[model samples]
Target: MNSLLKVENLQMHYFTSKGAVRAIDDLSFELMRGETIGLVGESGCGKTSLGTSILRMPTPPGRYVSGKILVDGVDVIPLPEKEVRRNIRWQKISMVFQGAMNCLTPVYTIGRQMMETLNEHSDLSRSDAESLIAEYLGLVGLSPEIVQRYPHELSGGMKQRAVIATALFLKPEIIILDEPTTALDVIVQAQIINLLKKLKQQFSLSFIFITHDLALEAEISDRICVMYAGKIVELGSNAQIYGTQSPKHPYTERLLAATPRLFKKVEQLQFIPGTPPDLIAPPKGCRFSPRCNKAFDRCFQEEPPLIEIEPGHMSACWLHHRG
Candidate 1:
């Protein structure tokens, strides 16, 4: 499969009064065309930062210090701002942000918002833009008439659908879905997940689905990347990630244990011992070593590089690499 998006040695750092915070460190991954890749991690694990950096969105006090982001083989890291705006953004890559419900304009009707998106990126007149809006809304299983309603009048699920519809309006090749169902109820989340599955097939789109929900990611992703602190601790296929076998990384195992499964009954779920280390002044060795029960002397003295354990399974723990 050809890679539609390739991120290599990506790093994002934040300058603060305390010190330099390493938000994302040496993260690398590839998303094949028409594949769904899930980025799973706990809060403050740089999942959202990774997504935003790919799109080159505003990151105040933060900068992309190093690395390469190649979309369709074009290195986006050092591309001129004008070229990125004119050639890369929106037309090729788009984002369905985390809080998409609040992204809608309260004053404007859904139709107007959709039309604005179409007009800005596409060469469509007022009437043609309105027609395109109807087509996109229909694509996302929403009625064309709903376009006339304002954001305040629509339900939470409806607002999210509208936001997704707007994202698909440009027919982007790669879409970053950053916790699209985070604010919705269970029923609504299911609906949104189903809708995403449907759209993925219809559009043949490659996605970077960022979320803390492990079960949900297992359901939709082709591959999973487990991140901890500011680095990728594990990367594997969905089966490798969710199979009966325990994950190699202790952090990954704890995350899987914490998730609530449908059939299994977990009386007392195991919790990770300590909080994630501060990026401003991160500990010397492995960032997860302090909380990890499997930590040893080497774990405290040296950071482990991500190494391939099996054919496609990669882990960055000394235990896995040494054994």
Candidate 2:
């Protein structure tokens, strides 16, 4: 059976005045039906780029150079932009973008923005569309009356709920949630995470949850993909990733070390020393080699392929690849 989403050796880059920046280089992954995959990485590691690439809607500076983004056995890259917008985008996949609370245009009321999506995607009558929008608002614990109000009128949590409600209104198969809970209070964050879990089960949705919080990711993600520099350095189940016995990838090991374990108290928290590599002129070998503690001759001279260390665990590191 075909995966819900399959991306093979996808390469996306930005053409800057200085040079080309490989925002996403040779990235590949799969998301099965109803599976939530957490994409965890430090900032500027192309997490957002990967999200935008799914809709084939990268911003002006960046472009999808090559690869296949197959959704349920259909390749989306070859489709015309207008066709994709009319059919695939939103109707099949939607994004609750980072700062989605601010996604609503200041000029349009919540109802109007929601109506815009419903009108453009489906042929539902005006009255029917408004009813559907109201129903979704109510489902997200928001009053139907709030649709007439503007974005500024609602509180932060309310705006986020409204945004999510809008994304779900069309009932897409896949949702890319990029930092969905950033800038929210702890209580509000937990509420949103719980809501997401409930919605996924209700809709049988596949989710690509991109965030830096591995702990939070572990709570919701069935599989976790750890990114470094412009590539996926490690991919595994939550248990394999958080395993105590296995050494794991050096990058993943440091990430786990840095994560705050509320129950397992540590003497002192750790940090990944040094900085991420420059994508514009990245090193020839492993992108994380400059910062890896286990770097050796092979690490400096040759890039490691992402190899499956076990049935479902894959890591891109010379140490794991060495025979």
Candidate number achieving the greatest TM-score relative to the actual structure: 1
Query: For residues 1-323, could you state the per-residue lDDT of candidate 2 as single tens digits?
Result: 23899999999999899998999999999999889999999999989999999977987699888999998888898999898978789988999999989767889899998899888788999999989999999888899999899999988888999989988877899999999998798889999999999889888888999999988988899899999877999999988887665437899889888988889999999998988989999998999998888899889988999999989999999997667
Per-residue lDDT tens digits of candidate 1, residues 82-128? Answer: 88877777878899988978978788888888888777777888888
Point out where model 1 deviates above 4 Å: none
Give the least accurate 10-residue stretch of model 1, judged by summed lDDT.
113-122
lDDT of 1 at 210: 94
Candidate 2 backbone collisions, by pair: none
What C-alpha lDDT values do all the predictions have?
Answer: 0.88, 0.89
Q: Model 2 residue 315 lDDT?
A: 92
Error of 1 at 314 (Å): 0.5
Candidate 2 lDDT for residue 248: 77
List the lowest-lDDT window of 10 residues for candidate 2.
239-248
